[model samples]
Target chain A: MTTRLVEGSAVVAEAMVRAGCRFFAGYPMTPFTEVLEHMAESLPRVDGVCINAESELEAVGMVWGAAAAGARAATGSTGQGLSLMQESIAEAAMAGIGFVVLNMARGQGDYFQATRGGGHGDYRTPVLAPSGPAEVTELVADAFELAERWRNPVVVVGDYYMAHTWVDLDVAAAVPDPPPAPDWALDGSSGGTGSAKLVSPLGTTKQRDGVGYDLAAHYDHCAQRRQAMTEGIAPRAECLHTDDADVVLVAYGTMARYAEAVVTACRTEGLRLGLVRPITLWPYPSEIVAEACAETKVVAVYENNAGQMIDDVNLALLGAAPVVGINGFRTDSSAFGIAPDVTVENLTASVQALFEQYG
Target chain B: MYHRRVEREILFTGIGGQGIQLAARTLAEAAIADGRRAQLFSSYGGMMRGGNSDAFLVVADDAITSPPVVGTAWAAVVMHHEHAAGVWPKLTESSLTLINRSVVAAECRPGTGAVVEIDALDIATGLGAPVAASLVLIGALVGATGVVSADALLDSAARVLPSYRAEAAAVNRRALEAGLATTNLGHPAWSRAEVPS
Candidate 1:
C-alpha cells in the first residue's frame, strides 16, 4: 500500500471507520464541516450510519443515544457548536458511554458569555490537540483506543489552521484496519439472542436510584480510569535543546510548531533555549512540565488565546520556575486570516526580553 | 538516488475561485511523484469568490526550514494584474514572472529573468474550456522550470482530475508543449534533467 496525500478531516473520518464507528451525528461548522462531509460520503460505503442533526445539541444527544446502545459512535463541532453539546457530553460522561468527539476549534468567542469558561461549569475533558496533518492521523488512532479502554468520551481538538492545512502523509501507514466492534454493538448484536434486554434511562424510583447509583459507581471507577489513561497516554511534552538550555518555551497545538522554530533560532544565536510542546492539552502534563522547570530558569507559555493554556502552565511550573506568557489573539473571521505572520525575529526578541525580566 | 534542488520558493497567486489551490496541489503532487519532498499550504481568507487566494509551496531535497516564502521566489504565476503587482516585491534576480498578457501589462526587471506573456484566457477559450487555464498555466510552469517530468505531471492530472481525466490529460499535454515552445526572452534554459527513471 502506498501513502496517499489526504485531507485532515478525511484522515479523522477514516480513523473513525477503522475504529468501527457505526454511528456519526454532527452539525456543519467551518473546518469541522469537512469531517461531517467525509463521514457522509465514506461511512455508508462501510454500512455505517451518518446523521446530520438539526443542531449541535441534537447531534451530541444522538451520539449519546447510539453509544448507550453499545455502538461505536462519534460526533464533531467547533467551539460554538461544542458549547451547545456540553450538556449532552456531561450526561454522556455520567452514563459511561464510550465514543469520540472532535472539536475543530476556531478562535475563542469574543462575547463575555462565550469566553474560556463558556460551558456550564468547570469540568475537565480529555482533549488531544494535533499540530499537523501527520499528528492528526496518529492522534485519531490513539483517541479511539483511549475512548474504548476508558469507556468515556475522548476529544480530538484541532484548530482552524490544522483543519485546513495540507501536509504530505504516508497514508498507508496511517490507514488502520477496521477494528471489530464488540458483540454488544448494534451492528454486531442483530444475530444475538433476540431476547436481549433493553437498557433505558427511565424507570421507577427504586430502579432509577439503582441505575443512578450504578452510574455514579461507574463514574467513580471512570475517575480512576481517566487518571490512569491520562498517565499512560500523557502526550510527551516535546523538549527541544533543553539539556543546556536556560529558557523553556511552552506551547500546544499549532503554536508548538512555531515555537520550536523560534527555539532553534535562539539556540543558533548562542542562547540556550528549549521547547515544551504539550500534545495532551487537558491533562496538561503538569509533572513533565514541573520536572523541566526544575532545571530551567524561566518558562514562557505561548498561545493563540489571550491566556487559556497559560494558567495550566503556571500551575505546572508552580513557583519553581518563573513563568511568562507570550500571548496573541486572532480576530480574523477566516481560518487563514487568523494565522498572522509571527516572525522568528519577533519571537526571538520576545524570548530575550522574557529572559531579562524573569531569568 | 536522484535529488533535485528547489531552493527558490514559488507562490501561486490568484482569486479565490480561480483554481489556484488545485494548480499548486497538482505541482506539489507531481514533485512528490518524482521522489521530491514538497509542502503545499493554501490560504483562503474570508471571501470565497472575490477575495485574494494564494498558495505557498516549498519543494526541495532537504527538510524545509521555513514554511512561508517571504522575500523572493524562483517563479510566480499571476492569473491577474492585481496579483502580479501584489507579489512583485517578492521577485528577485532569479525570479521568472509569468503573466497573462490579456490581463496584466507589468514590466519585468531588466536581465533578471525572462517573462513569457501568454493570453491563457484566449487559448483556454479556443479550446472550449476556460476553467482549464489553470492546467495550462501548470503546463507552462513545468516547461519553464522543468522541476518535474512532463509524464509525471500528466499522471498527476489523471490522478487528481478524476471526473474529466481524459479531457484534462489531453489539454494539459497540449498546453505543456505550447508553453515549452514559447520564446524564452533571452534567459538560460530551464529544463528537467534527463534521468533513466
Candidate 2:
C-alpha cells in the first residue's frame, strides 16, 4: 500500500474499494462527481462494476440490485441528487439490504438529511462525518463495515471542502477484510431450485416458505436491530481543552477542523474555549458533547448551514447550558456551495466575539 | 530546529489559464515526494479561462488538522492581481507573498508580509515557455522557501501536467531553472517529523 496525493472523493473511493465495495453507481454532480469517476476507474480493475447511471434514481436502483446479489454496493450524490433516492434508500433500509450512501452534501445543510434521514418510517443509517481526506481513509472503511455488519444502509457525509481537498493517503489498512458470500444473497444459484429465497421489504418470504408472514414481527425485528445498532456502535469524537473550558463549541464535517484549530489557538491566548467534533454524527456523540460542556458557560454550534446541527447540540446539552449558533464564517456563495473560508481569521474573529460574551 | 508543527498554508491566486492550478499541485506533490504530508483545496469559476482560480495548501510533518480554505496563510503566490486582493486579508506579518511582476502592478502587492517580486511571465516569455510562468513561480517558491527541492519540483511537474505535454518537458524545465536562478533558498516553513524535543 502506498500513499497517493489525491482528493477526498478519490480517497473515499479508494477506501470503499479497500473495504471490498465491489459495485458502485452514481450520477454526476459537482462535488460528488469525482467519487463516481474514481469508482468507475478503480472498480473495473478489481473485476467490479461501476455505472454512471442516467439519474440518481437509476443509480440507487442499480445499487439495490447489486447489493441483493451479494455485491458490496454503493451509490452517492450531493444532497440535491440524493433527494431523489430517499424512497429506495428507505426501502433498502427496511428490506435490510446493506449498502453505502455517499452524501457529498452542499454544505452542513444535510445534517438532518443524513442523521435524521429523508426516508420514511423508523429506519436509521449510521452517519459518519469525516473532517477531510485523511479521515476519509478511515471513516469510509468504517461506513462499509457498519453497513455490512448491521445489514443496513450507512451514510457518510461530505461537503464541498471535503470533496475538493487533496491528500496522500493509504486507505487499505483501515478496510475490513471482505467476508465470504452468505446464503441469503440472490445470486441466481437458487433460481432453478425449489427453495428460491426472496429478499423482501415485508416479511412475505416467510409466508411463501411455509412460515407465517408477520409484518408486525418484522417491524419489531428491524426496530430492535436499529436499537441494537445505536447501542452497539461506539460514538467517536475529537475533544480539546474541555476540562477547563468556559465555553464549548460543537461542530462537525469540515467546519469542525476550523473549530478545532481555533480552539487550540484560543487556549494558548488564555481563552477558555473547547470543542466537540462528532465523528459519527448519527450516533451523535451526545455523551461527549455534554460531558465536555459540563462546567461550560455556553455551548455554541458553528455549522455551514442555518442552525441545523445546533438542534443536536441542544439535545446533547439538555438545557444544562445555553446553546447558540454562530454560522460558520463564509462568503462567496457559488452554485457548488463551496465553503470558501480558507483561513481561520474569520473563524478567529467569530470565536473571539463568542468568548467576549460567554468565555 | 523544527519544533512548531503548524501547517504552512500557501494560497495561490490567479486567472483560469495562468497555470495557478498546476503551480499549486507542483508545490503539494513536491512536498509529498519529499516525505511530508500535504493537502490541496482548489476553487475556481466555471469559465475555462480568465476567471477566478485559487488553491489552499496545507503542508506539515505533523498530523494535518485540515485547515479550512485558509484565512491568513503563511505564504501566497499571486500570478495575477485580479483575485489577489481577496487573498490579502488572509496574510499576516510572518507571511511571504510572491507576486509576478510582469502581470501584477507594484501597487497591487499585498499589504502585509515580506514581498518577493519575480517577472515570471517575462521570464517565461524569454525562455519561450510563456505558458509555464506558474512553473516559474513554483521555481521562485522552492528558491525562496526550501519547502521542496528544485529536483522534486521538476519530477512532480512531469506528473501533474497533461499527458500530451510530454514533448514540452524540456521547455518547462528551463522555465523552472530560470525562476530558480533569481532567488536563494533558506526560509523554512516546516518542522521535520523527527520526534520533537
Candidate 3:
C-alpha cells in the first residue's frame, strides 16, 4: 500500500469517509476542530453533509438525528465539550440509535467520562483508544462498524499528541468502503402505514393494536440489548514481553506509545519489564490483560490522568497482581495535556524504579 | 544506549512564521516519497508570528517504534536560535545540527555535534524567493545528511507547497539546489548504510 504523510485528524476523517460516514456535525474545539475542518472539506465532495453545530449539545443531537434516519453520522470535541454532550450521548445509547462519537481530548482526563459514561444511565459507550496514526485508520473503520452492528454509540479517544502527529499510511488499504445502513434504520418509509418505526430512548413505539407504551417493557428490551453488547463486542489490546516480565506497564492512547518505548528499552537492558496497551477501554480487555499479565509481579498503571483507568486495570487484574499507579509526571502545567515529560527517558526511569523496588 | 532502533530522529525549531512546520512536513513527505516511513509531530503557539514552533520527526526504512517525543535526536534544524536552546541539550555527541546563519547568532551553536552554519535567508534572498529560507535550510540539511534525496525533496515541495505559491516552485527548486550545493555529504544519517529489513 502506498502511504501518504498525513495528520491524525486527516487520517480520522479520511478513514471515517472510507468507512461510509455520510453525516458529520461538531462544534469546533481545540484538537477536535481540525477533525471537523477535515470532515467539512472532505464530506461535501462525496455527496455527504458536514454541519458546524452551534454547541456540543447541538452537534450530538444533529448526529443523533442523522443516525436515526439511517446515516452513518458522527460528532466530537474535547473532554469539556464532551461533558456538554453527555446527556444526548446517553439518550442515544438508551434509544439504541447507532452513531460514532469522537473525543480528541485535551489530555487523557476523559477515561472515566468515555468508558463509564458522564450521561446519567447504566449505559456504557464502547471506547477505542488508538496509539498512533496508523492504528487510528483501522480503529476509525472499526468505530463505524461497531456502531452499526451493535446499534449503539461508540467513542474514539485521541489526545493533543496523537491528534497532531502525522504518519505515512494508506487510508484506502486499511479501511474498506462501508456498506449500506442496516434495514432497521428509520427512513420514514413505513410512516402512515400504522407500522411506522419509532426510534426513541424510551424505547420503540408500541403497536397500534396493542397496549400503550410499556416503559418497563422498553427498559427490559434495553437491558437485554446492553447485555448482548457486552457479550458480542470483544475487547482488544497490544501486549509486549508480558509473559515473563515481573513489572508490566499498563497505559492506553498516546501514553501507551511512550510506555511501549520504555518497555522496549528496559527489555534491552535485561530488565524484566513489559507493557499492556488496551485497545478498548469500555470492555476494558479484562480477560486478555489478566491472561497476559498473569506472570507479572507489579502491574503498574501509567495513565496520563490521576488514577482514572487504574480502577479498570485493578478490576481486570482481580487482585491477581499487586497494582500501582504512576502519573505521566506532566512537565506542562498548562492543563492542555502537553506532556513533554512523557518521553521514553522519563518513563523508563519510572518503570525501572518499579523494577528496582518490586523486581 | 541503543537508542533510535531503526529510525533516525530529527528535531526542528524556529519562530512561528519561519515555516519550520512546513519544512519539517516536506522533509517527512520527501522521505515517504523516497520509500521510507516517516512520523512528525509539530507544536505551535497561537501567535501567527514570533511564537514558538517546534517539530519532532522520525524516518525509518521499516516500521517506526520511536515515540514522537524523542529524548535525544540525531539532528536539529534551526531557523532561529531564540527557541533552539531546548533542542540543543537533546542533541547527541555525534549529532549534525544546521543553523541558519542568516538569522541565528554563531554563538548559539550546540555544545555537542558538528555545526553547519548556512546563510539560508541570504541564499533565499539571492534566489529572489525571500520566503523560501526554511526550504533552503531544510534542503541543505538533506544535502548534508542524506535524510532524503534532493530530488525527492523537490517532488515533495511541488506536492505540499500551497497553490498560491505555485509560481514560486522553480525558485524553490533553485533555492533547494543552491542549498544542496552548500554541503558535502560528510555525515549520511548513520554512516549512510542500509538497514536490515
- TM-score (all chains, Cα) for each model: 0.82, 0.92, 0.94
Best-matching candidate per DockQ: 3
Which ten contiguous residues of candidate 1 chain B have the minimum total lDDT? B183-192
Better of 1 and 2 by lDDT: 2
How large is the i-RMS for each model, in angstroms? 4.7, 2.5, 2.2
lDDT per residue for candidate 3 within B1-197, as digits (tens), equals 66555678999999887889988988998888888889998888767888888899999888888877888898899999878877977888889898999999767889998888899999999888877898899888988888887778888877777798788778877877888889988889755544323
Per-residue CA lDDT of candidate 2, range B1-197, in tens?
32456678899999999988888987888888777788898888778798899998988776787574877688999999888888888789889988899999777977777888999999999988888998898798878887776777778877776678787778887888888888886566544423222
TM-score, A chain, model 1: 0.83
Candidate 3 falls in which docking quality class? medium
The TM-score obtained by model 1 is 0.82
User: lDDT by residue for model 3 over A1-359, one digit each (tens)?
Assistant: 66788888888888788878999999998789999999999898788999999998899999999999889999989988999999999999889998999989877888888888788776878999999787887898899988988889999998888878898876454334457767767886775656887889887887466767788888888888989999898999989998898998899988888888888778778998888899999888999889988988899888887788999888988899999998846645335577766778877888878878887
Model 1 is docked with a DockQ of 0.30
By DockQ thresholds, what CAPRI class is model 1?
acceptable
TM-scores for chain A over all candidates: 0.83, 0.93, 0.95
Candidate 1: residue pairs that collide: none
Ranking of all predicted structures according to TM-score, beginning with the best and ending with the worst: 3, 2, 1
Off by over 4 Å in 1: A107-123, A173-235, A265-269, A329-337, A343-359, B1-8, B46-48, B62-74, B81-96, B105-118, B162-169, B183-197
Could you tell me how far off, in angstroms, the CA of residue A144 lies in candidate 1 after the best superposition?
Answer: 1.3
Q: Score the docking of each candidate (DockQ).
A: 0.30, 0.59, 0.62
